[model samples]
Target: MINAESQLFATNTSTLPLILIDFDQTITLQDTIGPLGKFGVNFTQNTKPWSYFVDSYLQEYKEHRKHFFDLPKGDFKAFVAQLDSYRSIERASQERLSQYKVFQGVTRQALTDQANLLRAEYLQPGVIDVLQEYKDQIRIISLNWSKDWILGFLKELELSKDCIFSNDLEFDESGKCTGNIIPTILTTGDKQVAIDTFRQQFKTIYIGDSLGDIEALIKADLGIIIGNDRSLLDSLADFGQETEQDIKKPSSLYRVDTWDQIRSLLQQHRSI
Candidate 1:
């Protein structure tokens, strides 16, 4: 296990480690996708309620899960390939949203306004302190739908906006959403690509909490899974069982239940 005694963090200032954090569930207390969808539905003039889209999306997701949920146990690569297959479900959902113009006519100002309102309610406790302490070394990488939303939310919290790297919601010249998404980081494979891009320059410590983060978490120099997400935990347990691996191995991967633990761990690295 990594613990406070590990020498992994013995490097000097010039070689400070990089922290790649997942935004949606890792940084926030919960997933904001539902709120973001409701925000868009509220602003749109669509005759259908938010439930219409949500239900449709859930149906597709359920079908997708049926085919891939068994998971390839012994082979980690095959397991990740199953996770990557989620891209098809994501694409279909995005396409349906665009088809229905679910977010069309939603103004940028409205999004920022909503973000201001959500900043306090949704942010995870101690996130600000962690972000501040690792300001120079941290990068927010997410599969969130809108980069503007993440930036606006962080700005409202008085955090750095330039550190965000996520997908974007296409907006027209009038600063209104076009109900379309630019699919940049939509899958686990895409997140791994982002991690690899940074791995070229510095040692990486990836923190995340979901199926989408599986590959990136495994690929990083150190991976920290935060929260008690049952699905994620079960999947990792399955993978570990087949491979006869221990998930608590600190040198590779570990799980924690709170940000304070994460902060303490990061501090351990810095103190060295």
Candidate 2:
């Protein structure tokens, strides 16, 4: 499951400013976790219709989610404590997520058909276009998903698969998913670790959409928050107003609703 993601995208030696992004809701209009849950349900229906595994896991996730949102933003210890506090439920939730097939009760072609239908209906407009225009400069750092699924979903776009860094998904010899994941990016603190490797080499620009994204946003040389997630937006605003007295290091943060705006901003700064 671990291959070189860098090989797919290093088409040039431009030394351009880096564009780091999150997948799922940030790039697509639909979040991937929901579809993954749907896959679990489908598995039960096709195999053990009497099994309550999917339903049971969903309820467990609901419980884990209750306290997961309450954890502090940048505190890794608190985050681990939150996960440990809900370990009875949270660990199982994570296990279920760590394992799942690419398809259940369907042919690969049929799965692709359904995926395409979803793409037409739910994908964020302009994401593929903007990414395509700047393919060589982008690296995706996704938290929740395995690399295979993201690349599979975006293969039609011919996106260079070089720089996507995500957790690993294991599969059996028969291609059935195993309930084990190796996470490279685990906490909000780990985001800073991920970005540090790129900081000295490029003008890192991080783009993300949720509260989990805040740590990286603050750490990037320039950060862009997309969509109207009020919690994140307000946090950025508060960080700007309450934290600093010096005008010299004023926030280089920007918020917008569309990829087009990001394109315009990047185009204006690409020379730098």
Candidate 3:
């Protein structure tokens, strides 16, 4: 159902739509972090399911939830800066996670294998078709995995190089991931900065799930939301009751349950 805030923004026929695609639930069926965690667990502890690790990570960050949404925008940005610095140091030495051995050593082939490993099972099927159809206009801007991981995964799909904006992984002299993520210091708000860069140049169409994606969703000329029921519930539960109002979203945004709808919509809107 393409529910829009108003009539869909009129896009130019001569220009291709500049698309910003989210990675987690939007492109993939679920959060990439879950698979990453699974990779970590099996790589480290030889465990299956990955829940133990995820539960622990969430618990560790539970205290921060109080300020996660309520913190002033600038204050939250500053907080991420400090946290990013600290996480880089901590993850580098996280022997268990590094033992996953997927990215610890930074050979190009190893990265591709790891990317394919996850992509084979998890990547959204229809999303890739749309991307290939509009490859030139699409730019993946995700807070999901390392730049190496996203690019490598896309390469496996046989999708040629395209513009991507995301976090990076650092490697040692040996080409091993240092486990320290060099932070873009990105937050949900930073996404606005990204969309703002291109909104004027093209009819920006943003697609995402979760409240972390809410800002870009609302700010775009056309925001296509994936899984409205799930997105709102998860966002509200994750942020708190106050987020109920925030998740109501603007009319400019629309909803779709599957990626095929997105492809169909793009095909419908593109000029002959």
Candidate 4:
């Protein structure tokens, strides 16, 4: 269920440095697998049973890719119902979810602390440097699936707001999660709307990994593929397109090896 995220401000069409970033593996060293898996384990003693349920569902979901996207828009009830209907859950999996223990001793603060530690230790070391270098020049907007997670995560990292768009999470009066996403932004390939919402005027650089990023990436003046499993950029590069140009340079479609390399490239480009 994709929901509209909170925005710090409306799009600033006045010339601004506009940079769209992917928050998961592209920025962090790891993806959501670790945190999500930990959540599963803490939920029950028989973690494997739940893992199997999720893995099997994912595999089957991938097998019928088109149908997955064919799901109705803004229909959270139907969407969740379909998702529940498709899965073949064992009794163990059902019990695990029912008794879900979101990791013992894992208060939101503890998980946040660990996430911050990872950001300092495993994230691209030069990530901050590059961002700082272009700090005054471009708006570093993050687009991601981790709605509330991204919000809380960035606050820990001390990154500025007015530069992020993610899924929306609803919280109850006690501050516990309501388990419902509102005005979902991750529903369809709606990333462009995020970019469009920013309403910035600059050479747009859209960076991401999956097909989910296709719409905005294609629309950007600069399209960067980061750790993409799908070879969507091969054809783009074959056309002698530089990041700034429409021409192709297939070999130039690089796979990031380190954060320092990213900093170097961005700094070098900014100087030109």
What's the lDDT for all of these models? 0.75, 0.61, 0.58, 0.48
> Which stretches of model 1 miss by more than 4 angstroms?
1-14, 69-72, 156-162, 241-250
Model 2 C-alpha lDDT versus the unseen true structure: 0.61
The total number of steric clashes, by the backbone 3 Å criterion, in model 3 comes to: 3
- Over 54-117, each residue of candidate 2 has an lDDT whose tens digit, in order, gives 5766677686676556545556556435533543553454554444432333333333445555
RMSD of each: 6.1, 5.5, 8.4, 8.0
Task: Please rank every candidate by lDDT, starting with the best.
Answer: 1, 2, 3, 4
> Candidate 2 regions off by >4 Å?
1-11, 44-92, 97-114, 174-176, 241-251
The TM-score obtained by model 4 is 0.61
Report lDDT (Cα) of residue 66, candidate 1: 79
Using lDDT as the measure, name the better of candidate 2 and candidate 3.
Answer: 2
Residue 79 in model 2: lDDT: 43
lDDT of 1 by residue, 1-272 (tens): 12221133334344677788999989898788888888888788677788988898899889888775554447888877877888888888778878888888887777777876998999888778777778667778888887668866676345454466677788899888888877877788888876776776567888998877877777777778888777777777776722112343345677887788788777656522
Q: Highest lDDT: which candidate?
A: 1
Residue-level lDDT for 148 in candidate 4: 39
Model 3 spans with C-alpha error above 4 angstroms = 1-14, 40-56, 67-103, 156-162, 229-251
TM per candidate? 0.85, 0.72, 0.68, 0.61
Question: Per-residue CA lDDT of candidate 3, range 169-263, in tens?
Answer: 66788777665555542556556666676665567788887766766766677767777656554543443322222223433456777777777
Which regions of candidate 4 fall more than 4 Å away from where they truly are? 1-14, 40-53, 66-111, 135-148, 151-157, 160-162, 181-183, 199-202, 228-230, 235-256, 268-272
Candidate 4 lDDT, 67-94, residue by residue in tens: 6555554454453344444333222333
